[model samples]
Target: MNLDTPIEYLKGVGQQKAELLKKELGVYTFNDLLQHFPFRYVDRTRFYKIREVSADMPSVQVIGRVLSKEIIGEKQSRRLVAQLKDDTGVLELVWFQGIRWADKLVQPGAVFIVFGKPTEFNGRFSISHPELELYNPSAVKQGNLTLQPVYNSTEKLKQSFLDTKSLQRLQASALEIVGRSIQETIPDYLRSKHRLLNKADAIQQIHFPQNPNSLEAARHRLKFEELFFIQLKLLRNKLLRTGKFRGLLFGQVGEKFNAFYSDKLPFDLTNAQKKVLKEIRQDTQKGIQMNRLLQGDVGSGKTVVALMSMLLAIDNGFQTCMMAPTEILAKQHYASLEKMMGQGFINMALLCGSTPKKERRIIHQALQDGSLNILVGTHALIEDEVQFKNLGLAVIDEQHRFGVEQRAKLWRKNSVPPHVLVMTATPIPRTLAMTLYGDLDISVINELPAGRKPIKTIHLFESQRLRMFGFMRQEIAKGRQVYIVYPLIKESEKLDLLYLEAGIEAISREFPLPQYRISIVHGKLKAADKDFEMQRFVKGETQIMVATTVIEVGVNVPNASVMIIENAERFGLSQLHQLRGRVGRGAEQSYCVLMSGNKLSREARIRLQTMVKTNDGFEISETDLQLRGPGNIEGTQQSGVLDLKLADLAHDQHILQEARDAVIRIFEDDPELNTDKNVLLKEYFLRKTPAISWNKIS
Candidate 1:
C-alpha cells in the first residue's frame, strides 16, 4: 500500500474495521497509521527469577512452570488462579473475570514467561493479570528477545478484536510502505549540523527503538521538524503582513500623547507603562501595519496605554475601534475613557450586540459619516454592515478570547487592514511568545503603577475557613469591599461545586445585614444579569461580590480591596494570579486569601507557594509555565492559543531559537527552498498533519 492511499486498502482491514479504526484512532490514511507512535515499551530481554522480585520495584519479568490452574468462583465473577514454580521459588498468578480463557491457555507443568507489576497482598507476593507468553527453551537459550510496544486503545476497539497486537500488525504493514514511500524532509546542511536521522529511520526508531539513544535521536529529529514548520509558518505570515499591509503614518505625534499625560491624566504613568507607550508610538509612526501584542499582568496599566494609542489614531483624523470580549468590559472601557478624555473630547460610541436597533443605526450612520471618533463594543463592531471612515487602528482586549479569523474580520472592515494591537492580561512565557505570537511585535508592561500597594498573598488550609471568614468580617467592618471567588460556575462532570455553594451560603448567613449588599455572578447567569451584577460592584453598591472565573478577565472594581479564592489548588497558578488581580486596583491595602484542601501534590504546593511569595505577573507566568508546561499555559482548543504537539514551550526554547535562526538564514540566502538539495525540505512543509490544517498554514 502507498503512504497516500486509503487505510482500508491495507491488508486484512475490512469496512467495519476501517470505520472503527478511523473513529477510535483517527487513522484514515496510511500516513496517519505510520505516525501513531507507541506510548511506552516493555523490555522482555531482562528477565528476573521469581525469588528476585521485590515489592518496591514497579514491575518484573519471570519464567516459570505452571504447576496448577483452577477457577476460584462462579462464572460471573470468577478468577483464574495459577501457581507457577521456578528453580528459585513459587509465585501465584491471578486474573480476574477471564478464568475460562486462562484455564485453556495455562495447563499444568507448562513453562511460560510472565510480565507484570508485583504487589504484596495479605503478606504474600502476587502478580495480578500478568501477560503470559509460552516459553520455548531453545529460543530462550539463544538470548533472542524484543521490546513490546504498548499503545493507547479504546474500549470499543478492544471489544472489536483490535487490541494493541492487532494495531501493531497494522502498523507493521504501514511501516513497510513508509520505508519505501516517504522521503527525508530536512536539508543536508541542517541534518548534518543537528546530527539528525532521516524521516523513515526516525519513525521506525520512535516506534521500535534498539536502545535509549536511538529513542532520543528519533524524538529530537521529529520535535525539531515540528517546531521548524510552525516557526516558518508564523514568520511567513509576519513577513506578508508587514510587506503587504499599509498603516496610517502618524509620524512623531507625541504632542497629543504628552497633552493627555500632562493635562487629562489622573496618575503618573509607571516606567513600564511609559516604555510600552513609547513602543506603540514608534509602531504607529513607522507607516507599517502594526501587529503588536500588549502583554502584562492583570492591573498593569494596559488599558491606559491602549487609550493613548487610540488618541493618536484620533489625532491623525482616523477613527479607531476597540473590541472587548464581553459587554461588561466594553462598557467599563467606555466609562473610563470618557472620564479620561472628557465628555466630548472625542465622539465615542458603544455598539454592543445587545445595543438597541435604533441606537445601532445611529452609531452605524455616524461611523460611515466620519462623525464618530472612537467606537467600543463586543463582536458587534466586526459585522459587515458596520462601515468605518478611514479606520486606522483596531485594538483587541484580552486577545485570547478571539480567534485569528475573528480578528481578521475587524481588519477587513476598512479598505486596508487596520493596524492591529492585541492586548492580554495573561502573561505569556518567552518561548511560547516566539512560537504563538511570532507574527506580532511584543510589548510588555512588567511594572505596576507607583503608590499601588502590592497585594499580600497567603495560603490557608480548608480547616482555617472560619478564621478566614472572621478576617473577612474585619476587613468589611473597616469599610473595604471584598471579592470571594469559586473555581467552578456550577456542578460539572469532573468536579463537585458543593464547596462553592456552601461558601456562598455561609457568607450570606454571617453577613445578613441588609445595609451591606452582596452580589452574585457566574457563567450560568444571563448576560444582562451578569452585566448588572458587575455594574453594582463597580458602583460600590455591593460590598462583597461572590463570583467564579467569569470575573477573572474584565470586571474592574478599583474599590474592591480583598480577594478570597476557595479551593485554590483546583486552579493553575496563572488563573489564581488573575483572580487575585481583581483586587489591589484601589489605593487600599489589598490582600489575597488562597484556601486549599489537604494533601496537595508537590506541583500544586509549588504553585500555591509561588502565589504567596510575589505579585509580579511575569515571574508568576514563568513559574506557571515551568510547573504546568506550555500545553496548558493558555488552555486548549477554542482558547485561541496555539496547540503545539511536540514542542514544549518551556523546555524547547533553545530548539525554537535555533530553528528560527535557521529559517532566517535560509531566507537570507535563498528566498525560496528551490535549491537542488533543499527540495525535500520544501516538500516536508507541504505534508499535512492532524494538529495543523494544511490550508491554514499554506
Candidate 2:
C-alpha cells in the first residue's frame, strides 16, 4: 500500500465507508487522509471510577457495567438512555442521536470503558454521547496508551459509524501501510537549520504524538512547510514574470497627459498621487512588464491616478482599457473622464453587457481601427470579440472581483502583455496582500485630496432611530441628499428588501410627498429602473435614496451627505466601511450612521466599534481580519490560492514573514534554484507543477 492507494483498501474503510468518507471529509486516497491532520488531541492515559468523575472535569475515563438501556420519547425528542455503574456510583449515558446503534452496543451487564465530560443535573452527574469501547484487560497494552488524535468530522460520518475513534483506527492502519515510505518534502539542510523534525517523524507525531514536546515540534515543521511552499510559489512567479516577460515601452508623456494635467485638471495633484505616477512612469519607460497593485481608501483619488496613468499610455501612441466590476461603476468612470476631458478631445467609448448592438459594433470598429483611445466597461471588456489595436496598459478597478484568468485575457490582447495596473478601494491587510497579491508591485495613495473632510462615523442603537432621522433631515435641509441603505440585497429572504421597501414607505410618511422625494433601488430592479433611480439621486431631484447594499460600490453622489445603514450588525467590517464610503464622496462634512439592535454579539460589537473609531480603511481591515479571518473579508479575492487548511493569516503573520524572508534568501543565492544544494527544492516544485494557474500573471 502507498500514498496513492484508494482509501477503500484500508482495513476498516470498505467501499461503503470510503464513499461516506469522501463525501463528508473529501478524503478519497491514502495521501488525502494522511494530510487530513488532527484538529486536536486527547490524553487517554488515566482511568477513573464513577465516584472520581465530577461535573468540573473536562473528561474522565471510567470502566463500568451497563445496568439497563432503553429508547425513550417519540420522533424528534427520542433518545437512548442507559445506566452504568462502577464500585462507588452510577453514571447516566444519553444519546440524542444514533439511538438504535447505541442501544445495541449498550447491553445490560456488559462492561465497557466510557469517556466523556460529566455534567450535573438535579444533584446527579451524567455523561452525554460518551466514547465507549468493550473493556478487555488482556487486549490493553502499554504501547496503546498515547495521545489520541481528534479528527474534524461530520454528523453524517458519525451516523455511518465513522466517529473520531473510527478515523483514528483508519489512520493507524494507514501509517502501518505507508509508514516509512513517506518521502521527505523539505530539504534536510533547511530542516536542520530550522530545528524541524524529519518529514516521516513529523507526520507520525502529528497524528499520534507520544508527548507534548514532540507534538509541538511536528506542528512547527508542518506549518513551516505549508507557508514555505506558498512563499516559494509567489516569489518564483514574480521572478519568472519580471525576468522573461517584455513590456511595451511608453517613451514619452505626450499631449493628452499634458493637456489633462494643465487644462482639464479638477484638483491639485496630491503628493501621494504624484509619487505613484512616478512609479508607474518608471515601470512603463523600462522595457519590463509592470504588474502593479494600487491600493487606496474610498474618495482617496484612486480614479484620478488611474485616469492619469491611462493618459500616459495614450500620450505615447498606445491605447488603454479600464475595466470595472459593474455597469454602474463603468459609467461613473466614463462620466468622470468625459467631464474632465470635455467632448471629443480624446475618443472613448463605454461597452457593457447592456450596451446597444449598434454602439457595440461602432466601439468594436474603433478599437480595431485605433480610433478608440480608451474603452471602459465591465466583464464585457474581456469577451473574445472585443480587441484593442495597440493596447499598452490595462487598469482594473476593484480588481479583486476579476479572476486571474479573466485579467490574463487582457494581457493576451497584445503581442507582449500590457502594463497592468490593478486598483482596489477595499483595503487589504499587509499579511493578506503579501500572500494573495505578492507577485504584483504595490503602491498606496494613502491620503485624501485637499478640501475633503474626514467622514464622521457614528454607532447608534435601534432606540436612536428618531435622532438619526433628525440628523438626516438637517443634512437634507442643507441641500445635500441622504442615502438610507439596508444590509444586503442577495439575501432577499432575510427580509432586508422588506425592510427597505417599508423604510421608503415610512420615510414618505415622516417627510411626506411634495416636501420630499425618495428614490428606491436594489438588485431585483431592472437595469434601466436601477439606473433611473440612481440618476435621480445623483441629479439631486430626490432628497433621499433608499436601497440595499447594491449602492456599496457605485455612483458618486456628491450631494449625498448622510449614510444610514439599518441592521448594521449584519454587515462585515470591510463592507460597512465601503457602505460608509458612499456618503463621504462630497466636500461637505459627511456622516455615516450605523444603526443596530441593542442586543449584539461580541463580534458584532467589535465590528461596530471599529467603524466608529476610525476612517482608516487599513486599520479597520486589520481588525476585520482579526474578527472574520482572511477568507471572508469583503469577499476577499475568491481564488483557489488561499485554501489553507492549517496556517491562519490572522495568527500566523509572523511565521508568514519569516517564511517569505527565507524564500527571498533562497532566491538571492540561487535565483534559478539550479544549484546542487537547492536541487531538492527544484525537483519538488517540478514534481508538484501540474499546469500552473496563478504563477503566470498577477
Model 1, TM vs. native: 0.91
List TM-scores for all candidates, in order. Answer: 0.91, 0.89
Judged by lDDT against the true structure, how good is candidate 2? 0.87
Candidate 1 segments whose C-alpha is farther than 4 A from its true place: 49-58, 64-80, 83-90, 96-112, 133-144, 488-496, 499-501, 526-528, 599-606, 622-631, 639-645, 687-698
> Which consecutive 10 residues in model 1 have the weakest lDDT in total?
689-698
- Candidate 2 segments exceeding 4 Å error: 43-114, 120-125, 129-146, 488-498, 635-637, 693-698
Candidate 1: residue pairs that collide: none
Candidate 2 residue lDDT tens string, 257-280 = 998999898999899999999999
Maximum-TM-score candidate:
1
Once model 2 is optimally superposed onto the true structure by TM-score, how far is the C-alpha of residue 304 displaced, in angstroms? Answer: 0.8
